[model samples]
Target chain A: MSLLRLRRASLSYPAGGGSVEVLRDVDLTIRRGEFVTVLGRSGAGKTSLLNLAAGFVAPSSGAVEVDGRPVTGPGADRAVVFQDDALLPWLDASENVAFPLRLKGAGRAERLERAAALLRLVGLEGHERKNLWELSGGQRQRLGIARAIAAEPEFLLMDEPLGALDAMTRDRMQELLLKVWRASGAGALLITHSVEEALFLGTRVVVMEPRPGRIGLDEGLDFSARFLEGVPARALKAEPAFIAARERLIAAIHAEEAA
Target chain B: MTVSATNLPERAASRFPSGGRPALPAAFLRRLPVFAALFTLTAVFGLWWIASARGWAPPVFLPSPDRVWKAAQIAADTGYASATLGQHAAASLGRVMAALLVTLLIAVPAGFVLALSPVGRGLLDPLIEFIRPLPPLAYLPLVIIWFGIGEGSKILVISVAMFAPIAISTAFGVGSASESQVRAARSFGASRFQTLRHVLLPAALPSIISGVRIALGAGWTTLVASELVAASRGLGYMIQSAAQFLVTDMVIVGILAISLFAFGFEILFRLIERFWLPWSRRR
Candidate 1:
């Protein structure tokens, strides 16, 4: 069964005197354990779609269903990793990772153990006691990922989680995320502007058009080599299929722009 | 190609000392200059003692340091004004602490409500603005009429003095937390209350602590003002009564006690800030 689905959803925001439509008639589905990436331009309402899925905002006209339930408000079932590394400044790495579990009323020992394990997963084992302010930008974002994944949410929503990292760190985070995702077998809806990232990490890629945003194209790639464990991402990018997929997405985006 | 030069002395100084142990206690103590502080205080006292000996300054107007010390010892032995020196100092401190506690309890929640909820702000902003600029002493007449020049009046005076700054700073701090933090919290499935608890409150803490510090200083200043009008027991009462009787030594002692209390409270608050908000300890 599909783990998450968005059906003919429309999202609008108040602007000037009237409403500005951000997303219109958007339909999407992700099977359990499938990784999907929503690729779009800067103003293509990709973040709005992720927000709707995260239950931060509700669809104006349609339904956002997650794991067989209609998403009304945010719940622990869906966790978000934001682009700007939104680890709480007052909390150290361990406490930040344990926030969801803490809110769920888990005991200190249990949450601390779980948090320590998650920190290790993110290669931040020794830095668990470090405050968010003391960390480098890349470390903070890695901690953000740990916080999001600590709860083992069924669906992890990432909104350009590596956008702020420099090239070296970004490459490392991308590798780390793919490894974590495969090992955990959790579903993800990654929102990104990078065609390379979409091609590399996603089982399927959906291209979104600008303005009254709608899916411009959708392509499936269930081939095992693209997102397998122990496969370097650069090798995948160098593949002929990967280059073809990238060209196809660029053509679709340009067509949407011309139209 | 140009040759680069290196400074051996500068590099040696920059390197960590060998053995990786803390510096010797004697070396650290020498750097502290305990004697310098003592010498400065003693020089001031010597100048005052000389002036009194020469009759260059009136003894009653500015008592000799020795005379002030003697007067303090006597007051400590017996009592200053109506109570002992300890009793008077305790009374003033107790009032300030009680008033501060009450002000914090009331202002923090009110400030958060006002800043978070628009309707709350709309209802309270006018009253807050009206009361903010009026000196707490301006309420002295009302306080006397309502509480009848007793402990209640005194506490009310300090509470009134303390409340506005605490509330205003809290409101400003709550309002000043970046919208991005709020948005990020919401994205993580946090409810409105959870977002406030997890994100808003912690982000506003430094400002709120500063507000408390300011309120404490204000509270101390108003302690004597309140006692002057209403109290029969406190440092202000001791100073006022001593002045009436031309006990210049006792008045100086009372003034010194109040100054000491204020300084102590400031240091205590700094220590608490350091302990609880360790992330803010930059250097």
Candidate 2:
């Protein structure tokens, strides 16, 4: 069975008088350990799709399932890293990262040890004591990623985690995310407005449309050259093949908007 | 608009250190003029004390500092004619704490319910609004009727005084918890109770602590009114009895002691707040 599935999912929110549809009959599936990137413009329901998978919002119709089990609500098996860091303001870096495990009643020592490892994974080794406010924007976002992955869930859902970061930080985060995903081998569904990011990280990229949001196109990515060795993500971004793929995805998004 | 550093005169520092230190002592030394004024006032008081010893002012009207100090010692020795200052202070502290505890136990949960449940807020908010504006002193007669002229009456009076401030502050705090924080907690598979414990309460802490500070001040003021009715052993009772006997020095001592207690409590609360919420100290 596919590790996760969304069958004809549609989400709607109450508008001025009638409900405004955000997603419409969106069907997607991923096998175990696959990386799927969802690409679209702002308000394209890419986030809504991720939110459905995260169980932040219930779909109006159809179903969201994880590993053949219905995703009736958020569960431990699926962990989400929101676009905004959403780190609890009162907690310092270590506590925030250890929160999910703390909820599951892990011993304090084990939780801290695991959280420290993940913090080191995200290059935040010495920032365990710094309060959320004291962190730079990029550091806070990295903490958000660390927190999400701390549980080492079967599936990871990221909603444009690096959108708010500067170009340098965002690029750095992309490489870090790929490295973490490679090491953990967790199935990841990433949602992003950045086409270049989708092309780089996703094993399969699903394009989405706006208004009544729906999936428009689906394409597979080839990371064949670096399949054995770690892919240098920045150098790949400047390559002709990667740029051509990015242009194609950008064109697809704009075409849907124009239509 | 460019400013030239050359146009400004440079001042020499007594001891300058590079980097690391924040110059906190320099900030303190900047307030020397205010400290000097206070020192001058103390010197003037000493001059008056010497003049009073030489009969510069009537002894009956203006008791010499030495005489007042001697009387204070005598009062201490006699245990304030019945109860010692220690006894009075204990009674006052006990009553205030008891009242505050009862007030918080009822008010905080009530505030949370009122903030979260629309039905509860609607049903209770109007009644709370109605009762709140009525001053704590105005409840004295009712409390006396209900609890009689005893410890119960005094506690009821202080609790009533503190209840409104605590409730209002708690409700405001809970009502104003950041929406995003609640949303974030909920998205993490947390149920409603978990959200309340993990997100709402912690977020509301700063406001609730401020409310406690304000409520403590109100409770202290209510102690005066509470004792005025039928109390025999407190700072208020001491002051009132001294006033009747025309012992202004004793009255002043009582007043000073009460003020001192209030000031001490405020400092204690501020220290606790700093320890608990260091994030708020900068702002």
**What is the C-alpha local distance difference test score of each model?**
0.81, 0.78
Worst 10 residues of 1 chain B by lDDT: B1-10
lDDT of 1 by residue, B1-283 (tens): 1011222433554474546776668665454445556788799978988998888988999898888999999888899777999999889989998998888999898889888999999988887788777776677788888889878889888988888788877888787667656765665567788888888888777667878888887888888789888577899889989999999999999999998988897778777777887654441
Once all C-alphas are superposed, what RMSD does model 1 give against the true structure?
Answer: 7.4
Tens-digit lDDT string for candidate 1 (A152-216): 77888899998888889887888888777776677888998788888777888999998899988
- Writing each residue's lDDT as its tens digit, candidate 2 over B1-283 gives 1111211212223344335865567656566455666788799888869878888878766777776677666556675636776666677778889999999998888788788899998987887887777777788888898889998889888988888778877888786666545655555556778778877787667767777878888988888788777777887777677778877677666666777887798778777766887654332
| lDDT (Cα, 0-100) at A97 in candidate 2 | 90
> What is the C-alpha lDDT profile of model 2 across A22-69, one tens digit per residue?
999999997767889998888889878988987778889999987667
- Which candidate number maximizes TM-score? 1
After superposition, the stretches of candidate 1 with alpha carbons farther than 4 Å from their true spots are A222-225, A254-259, B1-56, B175-193, B281-283
lDDT of 2 at A134: 85
Proportion of native contacts present in model 2: 0.25
Best by DockQ: 1
| All-Cα superposition RMSD per candidate | 7.4, 6.7
